[model samples]
Structure formats: C-alpha cells, structure tokens
Target: MSTVAIFLMIAGVFFFTTATIGLLRFPDCYTRMHAAGKGDTLGALLLLLGLALYNLNDGFSLAALLVSLKILSIAVFIFVANPTASHAIAKAAIDAGVRPWTRKGGKP
Candidate 1:
C-alpha cells in the first residue's frame, strides 16, 4: 500500500510538472488551457488518491475510512469542476474574440 501510494504521488507530481511546462511553453490561451485542464485534473485525482491510500495505511478504521471517502469526494468534485470551469473560461475567451496562435510563416 505504501509503495502504491508513493507511486501514485510521484505520478501526480509528474503530471503537474508537465502541466506547468505546457502552461509556460504553449503559444496561446486555448492550448494552455487544454494542458492545464487535463493535467491538473488527473494530477489532482492521483494525488488525492495517494493521500487517501496513505491515510488508510495505518489500518482501516471508521474514521480513516470516512476521511478517505471525503478525500475521494473532493477528488470527484475537482474532476467534474475543473473541466467545466476550463470550458467556460475558454468559451468566454472565444466570446471576447480571443484567437488561436498560428505560425508566422504558415497559413492561418
């Protein structure tokens, strides 16, 4: 369980790092949102799951189970909310006439 939890935490951190890179490296808002939305959602879920597992490592108890469940619920909420929020923000950007990036020498 410890090993699994550790692996999950590491994976979550890796995704977060990749998302940070995407945010820094992407040329435009839409692409950056895509990276941030997907990476953050997955990273958060994995990290929360790891935390929940770690919480259970001491042995299963009613309180531990409850805490883990709460963590999972929060993860679920984030999974649903993040993408919806990202979509809404992207839509707003479109409404405001935000344009996608194009290469300088390429047909746009």
Candidate 2:
C-alpha cells in the first residue's frame, strides 16, 4: 500500500513535468490546452489518489475512510471540471476567431 502510494505520487510528478514541457513546446493555443488540460487533470487526480491511499495506510477506520472519500471526491470534481473548462476556453477562442497554427505558411 505504501509502495503503491509512492508510485502513484511519482507518476503524478512525472505527468506534471511532461505537461510543463508540452505547455512550453506546443505550437498553438488549442494544442497547448489539449496538452495542459489532459496532463494536468490526470496528474492531479493521481496525486490526490496517492494522498488518499497514504492516509489509508494507517488502517481503515470510519474517519480514515471519510478522509479518503473526501480526497477522492476532490479528484473526481477536478477530473470532471477541468476538461469542461478547457473545452469552454477552446470554444471561446474559436468563437472569437483565434486561428489554429498551420505549418504551410509557417515554412521559412
């Protein structure tokens, strides 16, 4: 259990690092959002899950279960909310006429 929790936390950090790289390297707004939103959401959820598991390592009790449940609930909320927010941002950008980057004329 402790090992699993440690692994999950490490995985979450790895994902967050990748997301940072993607945010820096992606060509355009939509692509950046896709990278950031997907990676960040997954990373955060994993971290939260790891935390819950770590808490549970003390042994399962009613109070411990509730704490884990609360942590999981937060993860769930973030999982649902982030993608929706990202979609909304992308839509707004499209509606306002932000154009996607294309490689054609970007050739130098």
Candidate 3:
C-alpha cells in the first residue's frame, strides 16, 4: 500500500512538472490553459488519491475513511471545476475576440 501511495504521488509530481513546463512553453492562452488544466487536474487527483491511501494505511478507523472520502470528493470537485473554469476562460477570450498566435504571422 505504501509503495502504491508513493507511486501515485510520484506520478502526480511528474504531471505537475509537465504542466509547469507547458505553462512556460505553450504558444498561446488557449494552449497554455489546455496544458495546465488537463495536467493539473490529473496531477491533483493522483496526489489526493495517494494521500487518501496513505491515511487509510496509517489508521484503520472511521476518521481515515472520512478523510479518504473527503479527498475523493475534493478530487471530484476539481475534475468538474477545472474543465468548467477553462471553458469559461476560453469563452471569455473568444467573446473578446482574442486571436490565436500563428507561426507565419504576427507574434506567435
């Protein structure tokens, strides 16, 4: 269980790192948001799952179960909210007539 917890946490860290790199290197607002939102949500979910597992392994009590459920709930919230928030931002940008960067023209 501990090994699984560690693996999940490490995977989450890797995803978070990838998200950070994407945020730094992505060409435009939409692309950056895509990288960040997708990677971050998965990374966060994995981390929370790892923590929940660790908690359960540490103690076999009702409190541990509650904490695991809480973590799961938070993960679910992020799963729903991240995409919605990203969509809102994209919609706002579109409504404002924000243009995408093109490699052959203007500032890309």
Candidate 4:
C-alpha cells in the first residue's frame, strides 16, 4: 500500500475510535449523536477512500472504478442523511421539551 493510503487508514481508525469514545462518554443524547454521526461519516469516508485507492494500485479496471463509485455513493448518502437525522432528532427533542445541559445548577 502507498504511504498516503496507509496514512488515511490510520487516521480513519483514529477518528472512528474517538467517535466511539465520544458516544460512550458524552453526557447528552444530542451530543452523542452529533459525535457519532459526524465522526463516523468522516471516518468511513476516509477508510473507503483509502481502500479504493489501494485497489486502484493494480491499475485502472472496472472493479476499481466500481469500488470508488460505491465509496462516493456512501459518502454522498451520509452527507445527505446525517444532518437530516440530526435535525429531526433535535426537533423531536425540542417538541418534547428536552432541555440542554448547562453548567448552572443542572436543572432542566
């Protein structure tokens, strides 16, 4: 694998790990979802891009093109869906009167 591909894979793994930690450690549902949605999308995109590049090292082929296209599709889907889901969740939470965390007295 090329150095760049390796770097991408490593960075993707790091982002994914940090996202998992954030999901486990964050104090609020919205915060956790934010971390999960954004970080996972970025990490998955990086990992997929790295894999596609590695595959392309064997020279241009139908399989390589297809793999890259699939990766791009996944990225696009996440780009469209993650924010929409986050917005829906935030709206539902607001409608239900869910309160944000504050440093003051921790009440509602």
- Backbone clashes for every candidate come to 0, 0, 0, 0
For candidate 4, lDDT tens digit of each residue in 12-66?
Answer: 8998999999999998877888888788878877887787677677778998889
Model 2 pairs in collision? none
Candidate 2 C-alpha lDDT tens digits along 1-108: 999999999999999999999999999999999999999999999999999999999999999999999999999999999999999999999999999888987842
Error of model 1, residue 6, in angstroms: 0.5
Q: Give Cα distance to truth, residue 69, candidate 4, Å.
A: 1.6
RMSD of each: 0.8, 2.1, 2.0, 2.0
On TM-score, the leading prediction is: 1
TM-score of each: 0.97, 0.94, 0.93, 0.83
Which model, 3 or 4, shows the larger TM-score? 3
Give the Cα-based TM-score of candidate 1 against the true structure: 0.97
Candidate 2 weakest ten by summed lDDT: 99-108
Select the stronger candidate by TM-score from 1 and 4.
1
lDDT of 4: 0.82
**Which scores better on lDDT, 1 or 2?**
1
lDDT order, best first, reads 1, 2, 3, 4
Model 1 C-alpha lDDT per residue in residues 1-108, reported as the tens digit of each score: 999999999999999999999999999999999999999999999999999999999999999999999999999999999999999999999999998888897765
